[model samples]
Target: MKESSLFRYAVVGLLFTMLAFSCDSEGVINPTPTPTPTPANERFLVVGDSGTILVSDDSGATFQAVTSGTTATLRGAAADADGHCVAVGAGGTVLYSADSGDTWHAGSCATTNTIDRVICYGSGKFVAVGEATGPDPYGIFRSTDGGQNWDRYAVTVTLRGIGARSDSQFVAVGNVSSLNDSALYLTYTTGASWTLYSAPSANFPAGAGWLYDAVGTSGGYFVAVGSDGSLYSADGGTWSAGGAVIGKLTAASWCASSSRLVAVGYGSGGGVSKGRIYYASSLGTTWTEVNPGTIKFLFDVADDGNGGLVAVGAAGEVLYSPPPADVHDAGSLWYDGVSGVANELYGVCHVP
Candidate 1:
């Protein structure tokens, strides 16, 4: 109980308390903070006939089949900002997936005809285009509630392709009637109305020109591909000839991150159905063909958003081409016809 001893004891106790507080109070050790993990890059969904779907996590390097609850042949597909996707196919069949591309459920727009194309335009907006088997239904439909309900447009033509610039503006490409001529449809009022756009003579050759697919670029430019060649619309109307691609181009998509546009389809060369991809640095400009070295028929091409591209085509072939414009060096085959399970892939879209 001496004064000096009491002072020493009090100082020791204070030092022990300070040490305890510095190392997390209540004897709880603080863990080293871990930085948040970077998410997986480049998700994609490739859809094809017989309601088949293949999903990829690393761009398009690999794929696995996901269950789609229908036997209807799917043609076109698109994904939203939140990883939701909608795919359309024959007999007005629509499939929607909430968890990226894992599982899909059926959705409809009340038509027995085929739904050729579907696009997700962010903010819970979706658009689908196809022909009507009968006269009672329109060719285009729109959904605002994440594809839960659809509102049909008034136009009466078979729509093959569709794209949206924003939540309200959209462009569709297809046949005006059962005729073999090309047609372009535009809507600024979402889906309330549409107008068929006529093109001036860029003088397409005297063949039955048909537009198969259309896409809206970043700067208000729209590019469409078809059996004859490629077409361009600077202001979403008043189309002019972009140029004639060598083969039948079915689908086109623009990559704003790399300033490239890729169009895909099949062509008969060397007496075989070969896949063709045309690449351009800018829209409405001349494009160069880059052979991915595949004889499979390619129907759709999409940008992977990481300076690369993924294309899907006949017999469920999913092709991945990396940057620096070397697509032939990177060929990862997703499907082959050896198993008797090959489905013709008609559409592909990047999952954000």
Candidate 2:
């Protein structure tokens, strides 16, 4: 080959060699660290008569469309340890999510019954309770496999809520069709057998007319909530009136770890024209009011323990209450000294 051509070839070869060595030595320039995806944060969901759902990530600070699934009014939802969740509502509807809540496995209630609320009993079991007019006395259903299938456990009266201290022990709240009396209901055998309570009194305004949700405390102390400001006890079977929960008191949820308690519904009765909820860190003192909207009627509330809370309501409003700047819910250690404003968040639960 010519001298100049040969020189050019040598230069090209040298350049190629230099390039190869450079790539390996200094760690391949800006090689991305396999971008560790920002794990999905806990989310809050809202469901109401609109048959649509709203979701938030920043402790109800803001939200966007988490789902447009199911055109039925979603009334209730329950979350499991495996991040699986289910929501039910009008026209006999149910929607399940295995990925925190990004997507869903929608299903028909099969009874056209309105599932008012649902709860997870650990493991893969779930219980949903509500009222129906069709065949038999419709009340509650047991889904052992995270709502894949449902078996009617107890059907009578209007069972609004179901909670379990354990898989075998639980309480379902609602009133029976007898006289002019309303009561709180309990079941020790996972809804197989049930007993009723007086709920402190039978008078309206102060008495629990129709119970909604039940929450179990650390020391066996349980609180059940209902419309028209209702809070009752399930000591053994008979519900005793705990007291008139502040606000409308539509739903009651407890965070045992932080000792946080939340109840949402509406503003004061009588003179109260709209709906609001009462929140407390101790549940033993004064309850604070959260401003969601002018006609905000909170239907449910839940804690995700990610220093946050989610509440849902009648209006299309959803709010979040982060772990108080003090992480205080209802205790001293947890007392972060910050007041958790009960914004109208729909539902909130821990992801991990």
Candidate 3:
């Protein structure tokens, strides 16, 4: 009876030891958790000159042109969380897509000036910036009703790029006609008022040059890129120089999945101009250029929402980098997707 009891005790102690070894620090048994699958219905919209709008349903493997209802050279596009997209362009064009780029309809814009850039800050709020024109010549337009209608705001600078950190906080970058230098404007009142910042300051000194595009990140960082490969960073308030690249950067985007900021533009080499792309892990401290292997000028790039990137540019060039888009690929991983039209593509957005 004593030997039997000793064997049972040894077995019980061994089982307890094994169970403890298998338990996590929180005293719960650890098991492999299944990862949530990414939705397969994600869409990519690329808009460009001649009112060309292209849609890709299969992760940018192929593209088909969709009628934008007007041939006004759409320049910029943004998509909200609810699948609503707004594209802005020349002649104050404001096109809205409720069905995620499948169909588009014109929205009433108060200004006749060309709207150069547009950003959708969820909940149906969108802000667009462009060249000065119309009776007021404000250059800033805001839409609160999913871009159905807009209201213009007055600012002295010709705003080319606009980015939003929130519905009430926004930053715009462009050039001052008189100064011939870059200009920065901030609006915290939902476009009700704006504060101007320009060259000749401690943060943005003189000779800063003109800025072309701006983008806001999920981490509350804003970056504006422009002439001579210049870059500027902000935290929704203060502004500072974000270093520069080797060429002119026309547009920038934040890839949340990879935590990288990608900027696209054109650079001159051997007296021939070709597209340029650069990636930075942080705001703009350091940059690494990626050769896209094409001579076309890349105007805009957007995160694929799955750790990849899609860039569109001159001659309807559409480039895609599949998942795990490591910057170290040295341009070998980029694939030139088929965009049907030959028109220049200026803006791109991913709608999930």
Top model by TM-score, which number?
3
Better of 1 and 2 by TM-score: 1
Residue range 1-352, candidate 2, lDDT tens digits: 9999999999999986766443212122212122222323565665555555555565455556665466676777777778777777766677777765667777545567778777887755677887745574566777766676677644557666766666777777766546333454567766556665543443222445666677775566566666544443436454444544445466766766567667777655445456555555433234554444346565777777544566665445554555544555421111011112233334434433
Candidate models: Cα lDDT each: 0.71, 0.58, 0.77
Clashing residue pairs found in predicted model 3: 200-206
Query: Which 10-residue window of candidate 2 scores lowest in summed lDDT?
Result: 330-339
TM-score, ranked from best to worst: 3, 1, 2
Residue 298 shift from truth in candidate 3, angstroms: 0.9
Q: What would you estimate as the lDDT of candidate 1?
A: 0.71
Which regions of candidate 3 are displaced past 4 Å? 1-41, 234-237, 325-332
Clashes of each: 0, 24, 1
Candidate ranking (lDDT, best to worst): 3, 1, 2
Candidate that beats the other on TM-score, 1 or 3, i.e. the better one: 3
Model 1, position 135, has a per-residue lDDT of 68
